[model samples]
Each structure stands twice: as structure tokens, then as C-alpha cells.
Target: MDWGLVGILLLMGAGGGFAAGLLGIGGGMVLVPFITMIFTAKGFPPQVVVHMAIATSLATIMFTSLSSVRAHHKHGAVQWRIVALLAPGIVVGSWIGPWIGKQMNTSALSLLFAAFVTFSALQMILNKKPAPGRELPGTPGMFAAGGVIGVVAGLVGAGGGFISVPFMTWCNVRIHQAVATSAALGFPIALSGTLSNIYFGWSEPGLPQYSLGFIYTPALAVIVAASVTMAPLGARTAHKMDVVSLKRAFAVVLFGLAAYMFYHAFA
Candidate 1:
């Protein structure tokens, strides 16, 4: 067995799970760049490296979502009604996203993911407060927003929190509540991304051994084991810290991740 690889994956999962709980990001944002690095370093097929990283990251989020959301739900922060209304649209959107993604080459996908991460990080840095009179949108508007979020999440293999949390806050939802609700949203996003990646990648050649469609099962098992343990701890910390400050710090990290991916794409 490759102990070094196992160690790296374990560490990745732990960090990703913590981020999922703390930022309601479902851990994909944290996992994607590093997983890309791992796949590239291992000499995986150039055409499939980005796709595999994204697909695997989304798969990990499936576990982290449940673990983190459970913790958030206990704090009474999740908005179930909002989750219900948004989910249907999210599901439909997610189905479309992978098809769109498959049309792009690895370089294009990586560059796009870099762009997505950078945009999200900038929003945190700006910290734009909403107008007091703003409120959650009507059902139609909410559904439309959910579709957009889902599509983007599936495209980049993220949890949709980057867009969802900010959108909720812009609609005057409290930050804590928005975070929790975003965590809840991770489920559908992860589910769709996972399934779609699998479907899209199923027939691709040169997949590494132990792969399930686009997912590397060995890494998936190890990452899920570690992430599930750390998620609740991160959730507890989220409640105690100055969340805005934490978010700003995380944004800086996102910037670095984005830069690296940009380089990977262009260079």
C-alpha cells in the first residue's frame, strides 16, 4: 500500500471536513485543488485529471454534507423550508451541469474552476451587507437562484455554498442561518455532481485502478473516514468564532487555491 498517498488523503479529508462545517462549503472547495495536484503528480491521464479530482471531491462532499449538516441542524440554524423550495430546482440544474462540463477540456475546466473560486473569495473580501428591507425572494425567484447555484456547483464540483450563502445573505438571511442552510443544500449538489461525474466518466479510458467512474474509490474511502470525524468539530468551532473573520481568512486561502489552479491550467 502507498502509505504516503493514504496519509495525504487523510489529511485532505480532515481539513476539508473542517472547512465544510465552518464555512458550509461541503469541503469540495478545499479538496478540489489539492486533489488536482494529487492526480497530476500521480501521472493520471491529462484529459481526465481535473474531472477525476472534481468528481472525487464531490463524492467526499456526500459524506461530509451529512456529517456537517447534522451538527448545524442541532444548532437550529438550517432553514428547512428554504431547502425544500430550492432543492427541486437544484436537482434539475445539477443534471444539466455535468453535461455542460463534459463539453469543456481539462484546461478549460480548470480555468473555469479558478474563476469560480476567485469570484467567491472576492465576495467574502468585499463583505457587502444587504439592504435592511431585502428579504428572501418569492418561490419562482428562489427556484431560479437554486438552479443557477446547482449548475455552478456541479460544474466545479463545489457544494454551492460559495454562491448559496452569499445569495441567502443578500436576501437578508442571517449569516449563521445562511451557512447552515448552505450546508443543507450540499446534499443535492453533491449527489448530483457525484452521479453525473460517474455517468460522464464511465467510458473514459486510462482511468486509474480502483476507480468507480470518475471517483478513486481508495481515496474516497479514506477521505470519507477522516472527514466525517472532523466535520462536527468544525461545526462546533463555527458557532464559537467570529464567523466573518473566519470567512475572510478562508477567502485568502481560496485566493491561493485559485491562483494555483489558474497556473495549472495555463502553464
Candidate 2:
């Protein structure tokens, strides 16, 4: 194990986790690109590096999501009903996501990730509101929406907060409630997505040492350690300040990450 690399991963985890807690995301959006760069620097196979990064990102989220949710729940902000309604469809969609991802080549997946990140960033920057008096969908509609969120989140290793928060807020949920609920939703998204990635990549060739399927266990361990510890802090911070400005700042960061991914995709 390279201690230096481990240090870098720890730093990445801290940053990602803080962002996750603050934003109600699972931190996968921050972890994926940085982990990819790390793996690439270590000369992991280009074809599999992105997959490994995403898988590990999801794995880390399993812990970070739990930590964030615990903090949010303490504040009584989580909407358990919404989580229950969305989980089933999320599981199904997450299960299918890795299979579809595995079918694509590295460049394609990178481009897709870039596009997704760019869209999320733009949405944040625009801060658009739904038409007046818009409400959340019915149970069946929510299920379908969950499925879409799951598929896209699984493919990109995100916790689905970007979609879920907006959806909830549009339906008249308070911003705090929406953010907290999104944190709750991250659990199923990360769990199902991580399992799918592991199953999909179990027999793939050219994996790095210390990897289980597409997840690099060493990095996962280091990242989880840092991220879990920092997530609560982020949740606390989110409760204390104006998150709207933070969201815009986060959008700028996402745009930079999108550009990074785009560069890597076509390089």
C-alpha cells in the first residue's frame, strides 16, 4: 500500500464527504472524478479505471450516506414516507444500471458522466422553480421518477440528491426537508448501485490489485474512514447557514469537474 496515495485518498474523502453532508448528496459526484484520477495515476488499466472509480465511490457512499442521514434525522428533517415510496423502484433501476454501464466503453461512459454532471450544475446555477402550485407526483408517478433517478445515479455513482431534492421542493416540500429526505434516499441508491457494480465487474479482466470486482478495497477503506467522520460536520454546517449560496458555489465546482471529465474522455 502506498501511504502517499492513501493520504491523497483520505483528503479526497474528507472533501467529498463534507460536500455530501452539506448538499445532501452521497458524495459520489465528488469522489468519482478524483478517484479516477488517482487510479489512472497509479497506472490502472484505462478501460476499467472509470468503472473502478465509480464502484468505489458508491461503496464509500454506503457509509457517508448513513452518516449524513443520521445527522439529518436528528433534526427531524427526513421524510420517511418519501424514502419508502422511492426505495423499491430505486433498487430495481440501480440493479440494471451497472449492466448498462458495463456495455459502454471508457470514453462513452466518461462522456455520459460529464454530460450528467454538466446538466446538474446548470440546474443548480439556474435555480429554476416549478410553476406555481406544482405538487409532487402520486405514488405511481414517484415510483417512475425514482426509477429514472436510480438509473442515472447508478451509472454516475451519485446518491440521487441532485434530482431528488429538486423533485421534492417542486412538490412543495421545504428545502430543508427535501435535503434531508435526499440524504435518506442515498442509502438505497448506494447500496443497490454498489452491489450491481460488484456483480457486473466480478469477472472482468485487468483489475488492479486489492480490488473486489470494480471496487478498490484499499481506497474504499481509507475514503470511508475520512468521509464518515466528516459527514456529520457537513450536515451540521448545512443546518447553520444559507445553503443557496453554497449550492451555487457547488455548481461551479461541478462545472469544473465536468470539464475535467470531458478532457479525460477525449484525451
Candidate 3:
């Protein structure tokens, strides 16, 4: 549609994708809140824009996660066994979480999202010197963790890396591998969340033009293009730099964003 809008979308995707790889975040943590602001500025109905932004963000994350996961897999950083064990729970939880989220007020959702962002930032800052080795959670336990992560993912339109990495680390998986596995898990979270967004928005009318259910096509196009291309670069950067330093920097950024979001929601 509009070339200018397309450009913005691409930049958003690239930036979000790069951050996802570099910071071990799902990218949604950055993308959703920002996209919501964009939609708000465009004069979309405030009540609906937040949901649309989050849903579109999840859709874009689906692609970014693939790129990030592949890069991690190549480096032997992904834990396939864990991904397999957790996917079922993630899929089911992701599907249900959005349904519940759709019923909540816009301000409440934004506040919840802000809290999650702050928590993620704190976790990154605190998780310096990870624990020892990998511990395989049996089927039941893995599913439990996945379900929790999935529900959150659905509500926030996130990759769940914010929660997944720590959970994996707590289970004794190495930090790098935990981030990688979390990246892979994002794919399922995005897929289920996207579907749920569509379901939730299917009957509603009078949305902004160029939207497909809850996803705004223009934004999705931009985000997917930029993020997919640059995510690998972030993965590469992770290899070159000191992880603790990067994590600290990432935490600062998250804190700033969280503060901005809190203001946006309340003010």
C-alpha cells in the first residue's frame, strides 16, 4: 500500500529482529508496545489498537524466530529435546491465553505488558553467571513450564524468551542454549497467538484498512522484512561481544521502554 508505511514496517521488523537475537528477548517485548504507539498515533481506535499491535507483532515474530532459531541451531546452541517436550503445552496455552486477553481492558493489558517487560529486564540483569548444566524435565514438567510461558505469550504477543530463558536456566540448561531453545519456542508461540488473534478479531468490523484479522498488513510487512534480515547479525554479535555487558545494555533498554510504556498506558 503506502510506500512510507511499508518502509516503517521494514525498519521496525529489522530493529526488533536484531534486538531479539542480541538481547535474548522474543522481540515482541520491544515490538508490541512500540507498534501500539504507532497505531495510536495513526488515530486508530485506542481500545482496539493495542490488541492489533500485539497480534501483528506475534505474526512478525513468527518469521524472526525462524531466522534466530536457525542461526542458533547452526551453532549447536538449541536444545531440540526440550523444544519437543514443551511444544504441546506451549501450543495449547498460547491458543487459550489470547482468548482470555481479548476480554480484558486496554489499559489493564498495557499495564500487564509493562510489568512483564520490567521483569524481563531485571532477569537479564540478574542472571549473570548462569548455573551449571542441562536438566531434562520429564514430559509433565516440561509441559507445565511451556503452558505457563505460552499463556503469557498469548496475552502479551511476545516470544516468551523473557520467561523461557530463565526457566531453562533454572532447569540447569546453559544460558546460550537456553536462549536458543527459547528462540525456537517462539515460533510455536507466534503461530498459536496469531491464529488466536485472527479468531478473536474475525467478527469485529471497522478496523484500520490493510488489516487481516488482528494483524495490520502494513506493519507486519515492515517488521518481518527488517527483523528476518538482521536477526542473524545479532546472533553473530552475540558471539563477538561479552554476554554480560550485552545483557546489561539490554536491560537498560528494556527498563527505558517499560517506563515509556507505563506512561503511555496511564497518561
Candidate 4:
């Protein structure tokens, strides 16, 4: 890999990993938009740039998730029972989501991606703390929630934390537990989506040289290496900081990026 490219990847990873830890937002919310800009600058076809970015983000998330989950698990923050309950549905649904996304036109896919990010941001802004006495959703309900989050993960090549964390919190899991369990789920989301994107995009004509299906390997390598170290750092900071303002700041950033993508997709 080019040293310059590796440097870029490391920077991306650091930013993504830190945000993942701090906000409990899927790193994809940050990763996808920035990666798309890189793809565009690299002379990648506009139609496929978002797909490539999403695919690459999923690949990077595989590593970032592992690091973040390790940190969270070390603190005994993860709810393993919930992970077991949700894994089956998440695995199946995540695998299918990206395959379907890959089949759509790139413009449609980008718009859909932007819409999803916008909705997630809105949800973050609007959702309030659940009542103290809230109860865990039953096993069946957890499975259904997992399926929904899986589809979102697949469609956008995200870690699914935005959906999963909120769902867990709504089900009466504490905030930290929700964040940890969601981190655990990130591996499955990234693994399933990356594999599906590979299958769906394989043999497609005129794809950039050295790309693995939808994923660009050098980009993935850069993003993963940097994000691993930084994500844990971000999580540590999140624990020490007041996060409401941070969430809003991230939301503004996401909205601005989404708008730029919308212009690129349409103009």
C-alpha cells in the first residue's frame, strides 16, 4: 500500500473509531460520507462511489468493531444474553440487506443512504431517556428488532449501532450496556454486509482495478488500522464527557455531508 494512502486510512480509522465509541452512533454515519469524498476525488465513477464507500466502510467496521467491543467487554458493559438473542436474526438480515442494495442504481442507493442517515440523526436528536422502570423486550421482540437493525446495516454498510443502541435502551437496557451490546453486534453487521457486497458486485464490469467486489482494499486497510486505536480512546472520552452536545454536533456534520452527497448524486 502507498504510505500516503495508509496515512489517509489511519486518519479515517482514528476519526471513525473515536466517534463510534463516543456517540454510540454507527461509525458508518461518519465513515461513509468521508470515504465517498475520497472515492470521488480518486476519479471513481460517481454512480458507484457511494457504494464503494459503503462497502469499504463495512469492511473497516469489521476491525473497528472488534476493538470497540473488546474495550467495552473488558469493562463488563456488554449484555451477552442480548447478543445471543439477536445474533441469529442480525446475521441473516444483514447478509441480505447489502445484496439488495447492490442491485439498485447508484443514485437511488445514495439517496436511500442519505435518507437513512438523516432519519437516524433525527432519532438521536428526538429520543429522550426511557422511564426508569422500563422492562426488557421479550426474546421474540428482541429478534424482530435485530432484524430491523440488520436491514439498516446491510442497506448502508453500517455497524447498526444507531439502531441497535436505541433499541436496546428502549428495551430497558442501560445506556452503557446498550452501547456495549451494540458494539458486539457491529462485527456481525460488518461481516455479513461485506460478504454480501462481495457476492453481489463480483464480476461487474468496469469496476476499479484492485477492488474486491464493492470494497476497495487499500481504503479498507487504511480505515481499519487507524480506527482500531482511536475508537477506544473515543469511548473513554465519551464516558468522561457530556455527550448531548457532541451528538448534536455529529448530527450537524452528518446532515451537511448528506446534503453534499445528495448534490453529487444528482448534479
Q: For all candidates, what are the clash counts?
A: 0, 0, 8, 3
Candidate 4 lDDT over 1-267, as tens digits, reads 567767776777888889887765558878888888778888887767888888889888788888887777778888999999898889888888887787787788888888988887776666566554666677788778788888889888788887787777767788888888888888888888889889887877778988999899978876777888887887777667678877877778888878876776686
TM-score of each candidate? Answer: 0.95, 0.96, 0.93, 0.93
lDDT of each: 0.88, 0.88, 0.83, 0.81
Clashing pairs in 3: 9-222, 9-223, 10-222, 13-223, 13-227, 14-226, 14-227, 133-172
For residue 257, give model 1's deviation from the true position in Å: 1.3
Model 3: lDDT equals 0.83
The Cα error of candidate 4 at residue 4, in Å, is 4.8
Error of 1 at 2 (Å): 0.7
lDDT tens digits, residue span 65-132, model 3: 88887888888998898899999999999998888888987788888888988988887788654464
Best by TM-score: 2
Give the per-residue lDDT digits (tens) of candidate 1, residues 120-146.
Answer: 888778876565467878889888998
Q: 211 in model 2: Cα distance from truth in Å?
A: 1.2
Better candidate number, 3 or 4, judged by lDDT:
3
- Candidate 2 lDDT over 114-232, as tens digits, reads 99889888887887755436777788988898998899889999898888888888789888888888988888988998899989899999898888889999999999999999998
lDDT of 4: 0.81
In candidate 3, stretches whose alpha carbon ends up further than 4 angstroms from where it belongs are 1-4, 128-134
Error of 3 at 230 (Å): 0.6
All predictions: root-mean-square deviation over Cα? Answer: 1.4, 1.2, 1.8, 1.9
- Minimum summed lDDT over a 10-residue window in model 3 is located at 127-136
